[model samples]
Target: MKLKLCVSNTDVLLSTLSAIQPLRKLCVLRFTPVHLCIISMALNEPQAWCKISQEVFPLYEVESIRDNVLCVETNIDPLINALRNFDKSNSDGLSIRLQRRPVANEGPESSKKNRSMAVLSLIYTEHVSMASSRSYSFKIPVKVLKAEIDQGIVEPQLTHAEVLMKLDRDILPLFRRIERYKRSGYICVTGTNRGRLELSIEEDSRKVQLSWKEFLQVQQLEGETQQQSQFSTQDQDMPHSVQIKLKDWRLGAKLTELCYKVVMIISENHALVLHCILNEDETAEVTYYIGGKIQDQE
Candidate 1:
């Protein structure tokens, strides 16, 4: 299997991977014929799914064993650092290709047949202002997907919420009040369809509630509104809330740096989905699925 990607827009690709680093350390890098997908580890923390189209890379090629899909597991830090260095190099061209290296094991069935390791070879040309140019290449080891193990990785099947809220772009200001309290580990986020969102945390008798009332716009999911009824009950009138760890919540908050618009889809007591729009056209975006925590109120 052979895979090569020529990154045309370094900024867009950099922002995408940078957004994923907080929540995930190691993620599967999948390259399809038309898209580059990042699948986070199936852990208890927030799971991320980022899809960027091939248009970002003018020359995107993959010759994999199955359906032209190449999946390899690698650390995100090196990839992020490589892109940062790409700027320092004043790179004229940047490309990444997959290479195989043979490993020496003590016990081998045949000397001719040794275990092969997969690596991503990053190659770029650096142009110096002194009318001098140099080339650089580095290898990042990776683990190729084995059969159905990683192929089974899929987006969380979240129960759709009819009400979707377009959060304030500058929400970091609101988070400051709660961030100062080191005693609190979790925050209760409650939102109503009436454009009100309340973030509250309680430790013993001391309580703090920060409300963003009537400042945000709430809407229905594209195909979900039709199924939900417009009835007012004690349950429906109550705000949809989720108790999530502050650390996990910050992961989604970090995405605002790359995304144009930050939307939140909340299924009370179940999960909170952050739909981050990377571009105006919405062709490329990231979906962060954060599961709710069921802890005692005491």
Candidate 2:
């Protein structure tokens, strides 16, 4: 299903959002003819933005779309650090804001208390439904739908309110299940040499601070020596070219067992609690402690 949305002006919205350092948040869009407000995550990317449109518009033909701005949905947080100068590297470019409204109060009410501001609006058509039952304010554009695809209209909007409701309904139980699973000895424990372990942990952080090759190398090393055994002759020869079908990864390289003492084996997800103890003979034993998620088997 396609999601529907309305914006004040695409150009101004993108331009203003590009200027901000942290480019993630619900945007308040204002326009003539109609004014609507929307969250920033919904309009951050084309796929996401496209998903919200109920009717797709053909941009080349529609002259009125010039002032329409599409913002993100109300919940997805923006990546402050991810904001960089706009680059047309991808088919759609870096996610930029539509137009933004200052978070200030209005007249007497503004001075007394806080009021939520309008971020963006959708262009409505006669066919669009505005009933609050399940209907939304954002309408779809026709220009964005001029391609060959199934279900051209907007998909259901993953609203902030909906996400919160889902979190409370489904995700919270799943989190509790995870906790119970960890307590049941389902998780695995693993670590590399001190420096290597630190590097591996750093690589997993969402900071985009490492080069692609560097990240892959650390992941490979940590994965290979997870079991506390000496590297096989094959592993010693080409550590990078080893082939091991471990869970989700197809090992890219062979491993060289240079250091055995600090090399610990573990499941990637449950590494915090379960430990794999391997002897020099390649035989192994797994020990589980409390607190972590279980690892999925390959």
The most accurate candidate by TM-score is 1
For all candidates, the clash counts are 0, 63
Residues 151-240, candidate 1: write the lDDT tens digits.
688778877563478875676667665667657787788877655778888788689899874557878454544343455432343477
Runs in model 2 with CA error above 4 Å?
Answer: 1-105, 108-118, 123-186, 189-232, 235-298
Q: Give the Cα-based TM-score of candidate 1 against the true structure.
A: 0.87
In angstroms, give how far residue 43 of model 1 lies from its true place. Answer: 2.4
Question: Candidate 2: worst 10 consecutive residues by lDDT?
Answer: 159-168
Q: What tens-digit string does per-residue lDDT give for candidate 2 at 161-276?
A: 10000001212232233232211211122222221211111123232111122111122443345443354532432211111122211010000111111122333332221122
